[model samples]
Target chain A: MRLLLVEDTQDLAVVLLKHLRQSGHTVDHAPTLKLAGGLWSSEKDAYDLIILDIELPDGLGTSLLKEVRASDVAVGVLVLTARSQIEDKVYLLDVGADDYLTKPFSLDELDARLRAVKRRHISKPVVTQSVGPLSYDPTNRTVWIGSDQLQLRSQELKLFESLIDSNGWSASKEYLFDRLYGLDQDASANAIEVHVSRLRGKLVDHGLEIEAVRGYGYRLRYRLDE
Target chain B: MNDLWSIRRRLFASWFLMLILVSVVVYWSANVVVERSLREGQDRNLQAVAQVILDSAVKIDTVIEFELPYQAFEVLAYSAPERIYYAVSVDTQHLSGYRDLPRPEASVNAFGALYRGEPTRFYVGSKPIFPGSTERLRVVVGQTETSYQTESTTIAVWIAVAVLVAFTLLALWAEFSLRHALKPVIEIENDLGSRAAGDFTPIIRQVPSEVARLVQTLNRTFDKHRGLLEENRAFIAQATHQIKTPIAAILTRAELLEKEVEERSRDSVKDLIVRARYASKLATQVLLRATITYREIVGVREQFDLTTLVSSVLRTMDPSAEIKEVGLTLLSPEDTPVVLDGDRIAIREAITCLIDNAIEYTPALSDIEIEVYETDNEACVSVMDRGPGFTIDIAQLSGFDTSKKDPSHVGLGLAIIERVAKSHGGRLTISSREGGGSQCVLSFAVS
Candidate 1:
């Protein structure tokens, strides 16, 4: 995950930067809110999360947070506040902060918060989702059973992706074929059935079922035993 | 002086004493004037009778002839029953009744005479027979003072009654007016009494000018007190942030170094990290406790849900529990929330301390249950941990004493919990739970 840490304290920031880098994350450090804002806007698309310190040398980190949220960027913001006053925390949470940590927080705790924020971001797409042991990642076009990616042909992957987008509703064969192949490519209606059969075999042990709606297409549902 | 401490009593006593003094002075002067008037009236009556006797005297053929004026004596008898006498004399010869009656001295025209052991008022009058007849007749009349004494006593009694009436009215007026005058002081006392404990808000109500001074003094003290508290709170917050930041960096840096160091040096670095973390924790708890104490002095409270607070705290602690492989769970009633009135920050800190202690002591992968529910008209939060149960009696734990069954775990957490619970009209109970564990319960009344 890529992160921006906005902190004025140099030593604390260095330690946090070292820990984040050692934990296999790309982190950028900003010693002041002005620099933080500049870096955030110039590289807005590059960051997946922001660890914001409320007490900044130039401006309140919350203002920067507000600017980020106003720009409608889908990045997670985790606030760090020195004072644990509940009202301020509640206000920060209300204003689109994903999470907050009080001062003197452990590096492990910071990592955990980063993971939770990322998970929340992932859950927001609604189309790509994970339930029990089944996960569908839309960005990478992969379906994961537990930690292992399910092996599927390109056409089967497209068909399964269309079913997940249907969100528990049946996907018609015409819709599945349109999604599976581009306009230049031609596919027969029976081809959707072949991909569905093969995907069902692969999903046998996973906690999911590809249910056929008679005369229409297939929908994905969790297996009841799970 | 002691008697004057009560405003009501002092006002009444002074008013009563003043009324009595004025009444006595007025009564005494009035009695003296009445006595003088009565005596002058009796003397005038006696002089009239002597003139009548002198008018009746006449000299004929070398001897003076006279008739006693009985009508004058009859008029004197009307005031009260009393004896009367008269005498006529020319050249020291007594020629009329009651010759033993005393004569007036050469320089005195009227005098008192005692006759038959009864006191009498007398007057002497002399008249020439004709303008130049060379013969002078003197007459003296005397009367007992029974009627004069009776009239004086009656008048004195009337004066006494008037003074008594005046005193009574003054006393009643003093009692009612004094109470009305001291009403503002009572109001101040009542205002102070009804305030919440430790509340330092100024006295804003209007008061009498005299009592206004007291109110102003109190308000000044409250302002100073609030100022001091605000400064103290700001310092604590700033100090804690400053202290915690460096300590956090040290611990994190040491941890980072621990990973890169060789195996033999890694252990020592790990120990350094632990000590740094412990130092940071102590600083946080001590400062947080100070913050709580200042807030308690300010005495602000609001109503909130203990269930919601407990659940939120548990969620915050979830990551920490995961690091230790400990499962922290909250059990609460679904329908009724554990709603209570208190300072939310203090309560949260107390609960945090309890759960933090449990997490530190309990072995990894052990379960710690935080149960919040209402029972026996009380809202309770009980943290049960699968740590080694208390070796010493739980009731014997003291906040000041560092000595404990587990030397590493001083009783600071327990002490803070107990203090908060007691301040909130709640109770803290530490007991060894069934089947090998310890439970600490903080409870407050529902209503």
Candidate 2:
């Protein structure tokens, strides 16, 4: 994929460029607004995705986001900036940016977001998979424990959903609270643990077990009948 | 706005003009009165002589001769110079000094009208030094035209002096009166200059009635404005802070969802929930400090180890620090108290804004330094960025006043930090360092 990176910092740009190129993206970089504006205004078909840094020499990335969205060009945008405050994030997202990353973010996260954005534009397989006796239903909010139906509470359902969503990856407790309960709700770390433990017990009661990844989060698994 | 011409000047200017007109009228009137009195006395003396001498002459003419009181004649002539014209056409030419009198039209009487080409006065029927019954004799008593000239000159000088004195006195009075009257306005101007933008201390002074009422009204208005601004600022801050709770929940849930999907499947749905969360935090940090009350801004000194706080921020941003290859360095003294009276949260946010700004702009290979140094009475925290130095037009980054789109003067993170510093009784100093970078300093009085 061809990507346009509108970042002011050369060092960060280089790091991003290297990481993105390794992840199979051809990247073009512009440090100033004039350069970025010239590149976009001149040709609309040169790039598939545009990554913006909010603080540019000539203009904010938002203007470019607005301009690009206004035109007939169907390019995707991923905004990268150091403004980590929640409000700034919301503003950028509201400005029609496809994705936003606060500064001091890892290339891995950026790669994840880029992949997510690319999958949106391209034709890809249906995002769910079933391995052996365990099956996951991301849309219906249901999970099968060895072909046996298991009942889970809304929170428990969300808890299992979070684990199933991660596939086999670990998620931080803070990350889970937000996914299960909204950010405004006062949910303690113990609450997340309680919910996760209960959901795991239900799966086990239906002949299944979930693996707890330490320092990260949880994963679901079940034994295949021989 | 244009109607606000200085009241003091307008009042005094009109007063001075009125004084000039009044003085001119009064002095002219006084001069006329003196002239009238002098003219009356002259008229009386001339009339007395005319009564005695003319009656005697009338009887003497009838007797073919009479005693001529030449002394009385001279007295009458001196008293009524240029006041009377006497013509005696007696065949005897009996008037003493008649030989030397030299027959000529004499201009007599102080009150004269121009007749023919000579200035003269005529008091007919009432005789002067002559009598007319059956005898045809006309006697004229007169003085030269130069006598009245002297009187007119003297009167003019007196009137000029009086008018000048009146003008000077009027000018002085106007000045003094205006000075006393405008004292309140001057005090108000001085108070406005010394007091800060948000400070609304009213001036209470005994002013003249009109000015007193005006100043009182203005003070009331200013007080009301101060309250309104304070309320608005606090409301915005509170709102900004309050909205974050829900936004926080949205971001958290999104992050949890993002974690669930695998590399192959994570590409579905919206990708901006975390960014939305960050925006909420930024808004709270920016707006909260702007709304704090001014009364809460005094004498806030507390001690905290700032180095530890920076280290915590480093940890918070650690995930990016490793990936970006950007260095975060803290240059502070070990085991030192960064004593300061201020909102710690605000200060932290200010620092976060600056450092975050630096980290955003600086290249991956460049370095960022968070410097801490304390003076005897002050503590300074500077965030220096080795990025492209601060531009000259950074002030123009926000507040597009001429814009039709209503940018609403939204400032950058740096601007928010500047506001926070000012609200805390401190200052945020920004300068471009030598070479290519920007430096920002938050100065606080030692606590």
Candidate 3:
């Protein structure tokens, strides 16, 4: 992944840039908002994510964020700030920040947030989404749990994709049926139930669950107890 | 003073006293005038009757003889029902009717004296029997004053009573008007009474000129307090940012060094990262405390669902828990919302602190169970961890205890949770689980 880091703290910036590069990411560091704006205009499409610092030498980073959001390029923005006020967090999100990290954050947490941000704003064609031990590759339509790849039939894969699209919210049975079998397909109504049960059994050990909603459909959730 | 009278009462009291005094004075003057007028009319009739008798007296040769004038005496009878007495005397000799009647003294035309055991008024008249004669026949006409005296007393008493009644009505009207004038003041009292404790908005309602200055002064005081509070808040925000940014830099640097340092020196570098992280957390907790205090002063309260709030906090803390290989689970009542009325930010901070502490203490691969439940009178959130239970009495724990066994535990997180609980009319209880773990319950009153 390519990232643009806009931070003024030299020591922190040097360490973050090194740590991000070591994590197999390409990064460009800018210490001021003016320099960040120049880089953004020159290589706007080069970055998959932009790591922005709120307080900069030239001006607030929010101005640059607004500029980036206004432009045609759809790049993910992650804000880094020392201010942990709830209002500031809410305002940053409202200003089109894809994610935010408070100062003194651990490198591990930073890596996690970066991955989460990338998964959320998947403007690129190929991206992998990982939840708990489960990872899904949208490009190849493949699912992996740890070292093992999940085996699912074509119809079951379609059902899993439909449930994942709900984002932990319940998807109606009618919606799942539509995704599993199109209008011309001749499949029994209970065929969706059979596929869901099979998918649920396979994912039980993968820290994921497909819960059946009464009078509705199904939702995918993390099986935290296990 | 406890005994101090209100302004309305004071004004009404003074007005009452003044009105009573004026009523008395008016009554006395009116009585005097009415009695005098009645007496003058009675005296004129007596004098008229006496003059007729005196004119009727004519000289018979050289002797002064006067015939009693019956028609003239009848005029006195028409005035009021009273016994009449008349006397005709030459010098000190009484010659005609009612010889015992009191004589009018010299140079006195009308006099009051006791005659025939009754209070009577007398009129004296004298004239010579012939022109230039030194001998004058003196005529005295006396009438009992019981009738006219009773009439004048009745009239005077009625006049005094009328004046009293009129003035009493005027006093009552004055009281009513006074209350009407003080309506705005009463309204102000009610406004202050019903106001929320943290409401510093000005009393901008229209008031009489007399009370406008008082309201203005109150509004000025509120403005001053509001400005001071806002400055304090701004200072806290700026100070928190200033304090945390450098700590964040140090922690990040130490974390990098931990990875690059030799195996033997990695522990020390890790320690440096921990201390820096602790410092950053302490700064955040302190800022949170100030914010909670400020919100309490500003009375920021709203109703929110406890379950939903805990779920959001869990989501934010999930990554951190995941890093430690600790599993976070939420067990709450389905379909029913555990609602609470309080400062949402403060309560959220408290729940976050509890979960953060759980994540810190629980071992890797262990589970942290957070439950949101409501009893009959309380809404509760309990965080149960499968970690080593408390070794010391939790009640004795304070925020900056240096004597703790663990150097990383500053105890500020628990302090913050306890403060939040108390502020919401709730309590925080930390008890050991039946097994080797701890359960911390933060409960607030349902209201």
Candidate 4:
């Protein structure tokens, strides 16, 4: 991941630059808001994320964040500030900060938050996701249970993808139906149950099952042994 | 005791007292005037009747002749229902009427004396028997005062009754006017009574100018108080906010030095970093305490779903918990939404403190459970941890308790939670679970 660090304090900037770089991220540092803006324009499309500091030598970094957001660039913004007041943090978030970390934050926490923000933005082109022994590849449109590839109908594949994307959280039947059929297509509610039943039959004795959450929808449950 | 404080009652009492005094004075004046007028009127009638008798006297051929006026005597009886007496005499002569009637003093035109064994009015007069004759006829008229007394008494009593009735009506009017005049005062009292605590909004209801000055002063005081609170809040926020940057810089420098230092010096560097972090935490807590106090004076309340708040707090704490190998879980009713009114930030901070405290104490891979649900009229957040519970009853520490806190804990977390709970008119309870853990419950009213 590539990130831009906007900070004015020399020692703090040095530590962060070294830490972020050592963590395998390509990082560029700017010591003032003016320089940060220049760097942003120079490499507008280079940075996947920007770590903004609120107190900048030239001006507030929040203003820069707003500018970046206003532009068409698709980069994540994580605000770093010594203003631990809830109102200050909430204001930054309201102004399109993807995440906020108070001053004196641990390096590990900062790294985790950056990764979380990256995950949210980069999940659009998900290549593979696995739940228990079941792995699905969206690019190749393939499904695997353990070492074996499972053949599934088109609607079954759609249902499986929806359930997997829910990440163990139950997905409502309405949500599943919308993903299965396009809005313009006329489909009955019974069609979902049919596809779910067929999928469940295929997974019988395979240590994986679709369990119904009463009054909600279905969730994928995993077991080590059947 | 309450009436002493009541402006309405006091005004009514004062007006009614004054009206009663005036009524009594009016009644006394009416009695005196009626008695005097009736006596004067009776005396005039008696004198006229006596003059008639003297006028009827005639002298013929030097022998005086006297004629009694029966009609004149009869007219005297019409003054009231009383007996009439008349007597005529020449020099020492007695003629025509009751002889035993006492003669009045010579210069007295009318006198009140005992006549016929009852109080009576008498008139005495003299006239010459012939024109310019030295000889004169003396006449006295006496009448029983039964009727005069009755009529005078009746008039006086009626006047007194009228005055009394008028005064009673006047008192009622006075009471009503007092209430009407002080209506604004009563309204102010009622408005103050019904307001929620710390609600110092200006009195917007229209008031009389007399009381409007007082209300204006009260409103100005409230405005000043609100201004002071805002200033205090801003100062505390700014002071704490400014404190953080240097603290952050120090900690950053310390961490950087710790990386470059030898193994023997690393412990001391790490110690310095911990102390710096502790100072930062203290500053944050102090700021939070000041904010809670300020909010107690000027609260910013909004309605939000309690479950959503809890879930978000859990998510924010998850990363830190993961680094410590601790698990944080939320248990709440999925469909039953617990909505409450509060300052969301303060509430979130309080929950975060509770969960963070648990994470700091519990062993690695231990579970910390946060449950949010509604019970009766309250929304409850209970955090249970399977950690070493406190030997002393933490719930017993009411306000600020730093005596029994652990060495690593600053003891501000519980204080912050307690202050936030109190500001919301809520409660905080801590108890050891029966099995082997501690549970802290913070509950707020649903209103």
Candidate 5:
């Protein structure tokens, strides 16, 4: 995936750039709207996704988003904002953003959101996987096995969904550290261990194959071919 | 000022007391002088009356040649009051002309201190009369001095009334005039009291010379601060937008880099470049906040020369100055050294930021002229450059922080300079060269 990134903090940008590149994607970073406009205009379909900051040194992301929409461009956009309220999220999403990620977000969570957005429109089919009758719904949260509805908390469901939604790459504890808990939360790499143990127990009783990353987080492994 | 109230109260009290004292003294001296003159005049008239009666007896004794009539002298004494007495010391027993004289011991001695063994002061103009040459009669006529003392007491009462009237009028006038003159000060105090609560209203008053200039400056200062507050509010909005831009860029780029890593594309080299751009923006924001906070504090002042201060700032930034090849020079030749009374550290920071701005904005190897001079009782420090100049009239607006909106000109530096200038009773002038570049000048009252 290709994206347009507009950030101004050096330390934060360096760390974010490292983690996001490690996650796997292409990013064209424009420090200002002026540069971003030039890049956007220079190459049609140069970006598969537009990751814009609402406040640019030169201008706002709303205009950029409007421009993207007016140009009939089909690129998915993920807005980054410091604001963490539901209204800002809704506002950005309404203003042509495919998704919204607030600041201090985990790299893995950001990666997951990107992948989810990428899965929306593609040359290939949307892959929906399951763990036994503990079926997973990426768009919804209910999972059932053996005619019995599974009861799981929101974070537990998120942990399972993250592992299954890794698109087959092994999910690691370090990756889950950034996802399961808020990056600004008082959580560590061990936080995944606590959540994964709970999730694996529920799925194993239902005859699912959820594997550990061995000193890392967990991964859900189940196929119908068996 | 702490003692000023007490001082005024003392003046008020003393003025009332002294007026009363002065009036009393004037009335006292006048009463004493006038009464003495009146008593002398009354004594002279009484002596003339006794001489006339004796003259009538002496002429009759010389003409008729009969025994000079003692009856006539007696009748003269009878006509006068009983307090009057006439005594004749003769060859016979004392021929008297007294109805009843006050006893010699009781009477004030007519001859005073000289009368003990001496003749009685020639009667103070003696009227020694003859009774057909057989005896001599001294017609000493005087009312007892009790009635005279009573007259003097009445004169003193009049002086007391006059003095009372004078002081009462004076007190009324002094208090009335003082209150009227100070009414403006009271109004100023009321206005200042409200302004103390951050009202920022212009004072409406005309006070005495001592307080007039002070009140005017206070109102002007309020207006100045109010204007700056308004500007700061605008600057805050502008700053929020500026800060948000970089934060948003970092966020959006972070998400973008994730996408690049997920695909494992050979062209993922582009992701690192994207992140570096946002990293520099972070630096910009940190500097921006530092400058804003440095400017925001209510600045203080002390005496310091700009030459030494600017040199130190430049020395710390020498490497950067060298990198830009912008020569920084401090050219000042005045014993009238620039005296600044402002927040030394904050002002130094402001100056350094400005110098840094000049160094960064100017073209490489271009001359950056920094000079300090004394002008119009003010110390002026100017940093001129051959780089791109400001677009608008920054000096005229008196409040426009800066016209340049370059990534480097976050406008924070310009705002700080303006704020510091105002604190030191001065202004910042930013004028463009006719051809190119800008001249940024910071003015301060030469303390």
Candidate 6:
């Protein structure tokens, strides 16, 4: 993925740029809003995501974000700010930001958010995604292990889709339930547990596994050797 | 504070007292004028009868003889129903008519005396029997004064009563006018009474000139308060930005260094990252506390459902809880929405703090249960964690206290929860769960 990072603080910017590069993302760093605007105009269509800092030395990064959005560029914008006030977060999101991260965020979390923002903003229509011997087609809603389609109930398929959307991050049980039953449905509290247990059994043989994060929920990942 | 002596009551009392005084003065003056005139009419009648008798006298060789007029006495009878007496005399010598009638003094023409067991008025007249004659014949007439006295009293009382009724009606009209004049002030009071807290909008309603100054001062005060709150909000936002940016930079740097450093030195680098993260959290919490306190001072309140608020807080805390591998569960009455009236932001922060604390303390793969319930008069959100329960007496913990068991745990979370609960006329309680772990309940009054 290609990203544009607009931040003024040099100490933080250097580490973030290094971490982002190590995570296999191609990044261009700009320490001021003026430089960021220049980069955005020059390579506006080349970037998949823009990591913006709200406070910059020259001017606010929001101005550059607005410019990028106004040009109708299909680039994901993830706002990074030290302002954790709910109003600021809401305002940033309301102003066309795909996602936001408060300062002092974990590198792993930042990478996850970047992927999530890219998925939301820039649509790359892939037919199938694979994990080792397992392959799933999102368009057809089918899973195959060595050319044999895995059988799953409608609820189980929905749970699988929710976990897949998490992008290797854990999806909470409440979130999974909401995805499965929707807002107005009447279902048992343990309905998610039953579906997850059944899905776990089918995925284990395909070099893919569903791991229950005890206090959280479930994450779908490649199976590790025991 | 003297509620009984309101402006209306005071004005009415003063007017009432003045009216009574004027009524008494008017009645007394009217009585005096009426009695004097009536008495004068009686005296004229008496003098007329006396003059006729004096004119009827015939002088025979220096001796005077007079004939009493019957018609003149009858005229006095026609004026009012009262007894009358008359006498004709020369130097105290009785001529005709009642011999026992009281004579006037030698120099006085009219007088009052008791006659026939009743108060009476007497009149006297005298003239010489012939021209320049020194010997004068005197005539005296008397009548009882009961009828004229009664007539004067009746007239004075009726006049006084009429004046009293008219003044009383005037007083009532004045009271009605006063209330109508003050209608705007009452409207202002009602407008203020119905306002929601934190609303500092100035009163712009039209008012009478008499009350305009008061309303203007009130509007100025509202403007001043609105400006101060706005400044406070801006300051909190600025301080959050100024304080946390560098901390984030430091934490990110420490995290990076932890990976590059040798295994033997990795623990120290990890500690550096933890401390930086803690500092960042502390700064955020402190700013949040200030914001909540400011809102409390302004008394911002709204109605919201407890279940919905808890659900949102759980969602917000999900990522952090996920990183810790802690499972979150919500238990609430199905189809029932527990509603409470309070500062929604403050309450949301409080619930977030509790869940955050639970996630921090509970081990990985443990579960945190959040329940929303309502009692008879309170709406409660309780967070239960399958972690080591409180070791010390919960009552000893202050908002800023550092936990003895966990050095890294500052008690700001509990402090925030306590502050929110108290501001809502609610309470925060920490108790051991039935089987294990800890339960923290934050409850607010339903009102």
Clashing pairs in 1: none
Candidate 6 lDDT by residue in tens digits, B310-384: 886765555566555466778785468998998887898889888988998886556788999999999999999
Q: Write the per-residue lDDT of candidate 2 for residues B218-323, one digit (tens) a residue.
A: 7898678777766776666456534543453355445445656676655541345535634664564455445333333322334566655565555445334433
**Candidate 1 runs further than 4 Å off:** A84-96, A124-226, B1-4, B55-78, B81-88, B97-122, B129-136, B142-165, B194-198, B206-217, B257-275, B293-303, B334-347, B357-447
Can you list the residue pairs that collide in candidate 3?
none
lDDT per residue (tens digit) for residues B187-255 in model 4: 998998976666776788778789989999999998998888779878987887688877777887787
**Per-model TM-score versus the true fold:** 0.73, 0.50, 0.68, 0.76, 0.39, 0.67
* DockQ scores for all predicted structures: 0.16, 0.02, 0.25, 0.20, 0.03, 0.25
Q: RMSD per prediction, one decimal? A: 11.8, 19.0, 11.2, 10.8, 20.4, 9.3
* Fraction of the native A-B contacts that model 3 recovers: 0.54
Interface RMSD of 2: 15.4
Candidate 6: tens digits of C-alpha lDDT, residues A42-122: 998999899999989888888987887899778899999888776576578668887788887777567656655654563
Off by over 4 Å in 6: A18-26, A45-48, A104-226, B1-5, B37-124, B127-137, B140-158, B194-198, B204-217, B254-317, B327-447
Decide which is better by TM-score, 2 or 4. Answer: 4
User: Residue-wise lDDT of candidate 3 within B155-243, one digit each (tens)?
Assistant: 76687678778877887887798889888888998988876555566788989999999899988997897778778877888898998
Worst 10 residues of 6 chain B by lDDT: B392-401
Q: What does the lDDT read for residue B89 in candidate 3?
A: 85
DockQ head-to-head 3 vs 6, winner: 6
Residue B136 of model 3, lDDT score: 76
**Stretches of model 5 off by over 4 angstroms after superposition:** A7-15, A23-26, A31-33, A40-226, B1-7, B33-37, B40-48, B51-58, B61-150, B161-212, B220-447
Interface RMSD values for all candidates: 9.8, 15.4, 7.1, 9.4, 17.9, 5.2
Task: Report the poorest 10 consecutive residues by lDDT, candidate 1 chain B.
Answer: B399-408
True contacts kept of 1: 0.35
